[model samples]
Target: MQNKLRIIGGAWRSRNITFSDAPGLRPTPARVRETLFNWLHYDIAGKTCLDLYAGSGALGFEAASRGAKSVVLVESNAQVCLSLKNNVAMLSAQQISIAQTEVSRFLAATAQGFDVVFIDPPFTKDLVPTTCLTLENNGWLNPHAKIYIETERSLTLSGLPANWQVLKHKTAGEVAYQLFERG
Candidate 1:
């Protein structure tokens, strides 16, 4: 089975993209995306972005639709990666690239810095802290880059980089999302 999501704004607004019904693949809700993008309104255009754990490619696609210079979506599942590639082709999104690999492995090997990054790992895996550390320690973020994270509402966000400061936070139902800036 497949699930579809609509791009709520930008050039692709109201366009629908499909994703496979894979386990642990939860796309960011439209409401949360709307709020996140609002927070990123001024920063997204012409920026390079990394969408780690790019399950459904919602965040990355949204960034590309909003005029991001480039977007990298890293996901390990073969089925999900295929869906992401198809969507990229469907949109003719020259700015988006899909990296088929584990989030940690991709972070370990890539040194390219990005202006923005979306971290929405599978719920209850406790992946955020370590992933954030890897991104910071491996020089994967540009100076003063913006990082967005979505996690289970109860997950405690600790062990993150010392210089990262929370800029915005909100909870809707079972999810808690936040935006952070590298200081």
Candidate 2:
């Protein structure tokens, strides 16, 4: 099956994109995305971004539309990756690229640093802590990089890096989303 979502802001505002109905894939809700982008309005332009567990490519696409210099979307599923590639081509998004690989593998091998990163892994797999640690321990983030994380409401965000400070947090329905700034 295919599902559709709209880009709520930036140059591609109101444009709709499609995604495969892959298991464990939940695109960030529009309201949550709106809030996140608003919080990042001043920081997005000309920035490099990483969207781990890219899923529907919502966050990545949004960043690109908003003027991020580059956006790399990492998704393990082939179908999802295809959808993301299609959208990138459809939008002629020169700044966006799709990586068809597991998040951990991509993180381990990534050599470049990003100014912003979006991490919205599948629920109940306990992937966030390890992913956070890898991003911190490795040289994946530029100084003062902004990280956005979305998880189920019940998931406790523990063991995150000490230098990361929560700049914003909000809950909508079952999802809890936050913006953290790397010190």
Measured by lDDT, the strongest candidate is 1
What value does the lDDT take at residue 9 in candidate 2? 89
- Candidate 1 C-alpha lDDT tens digits along 1-183: 889999999999999999998889999999999999999999999999999999999999999999999999999999999999999999999999999999988887949999999999999889999999999999999999999999999998999999999999999999999999999
As a TM-score, model 1 comes out at 0.99
**Reference-based lDDT, each prediction:** 0.96, 0.95
Per-residue alpha-carbon lDDT of candidate 2 for residues 8-88, written as tens digits (9 for 90 to 100): 989999999999998999999999999999999999999999999999999999999999999999999998999999999
Candidate 2 lDDT (Cα, 0 to 1)? 0.95
Looking at candidate 1, the ten consecutive residues that score lowest on lDDT are: 103-112
- Local error of candidate 2 at 143, Å? 0.2
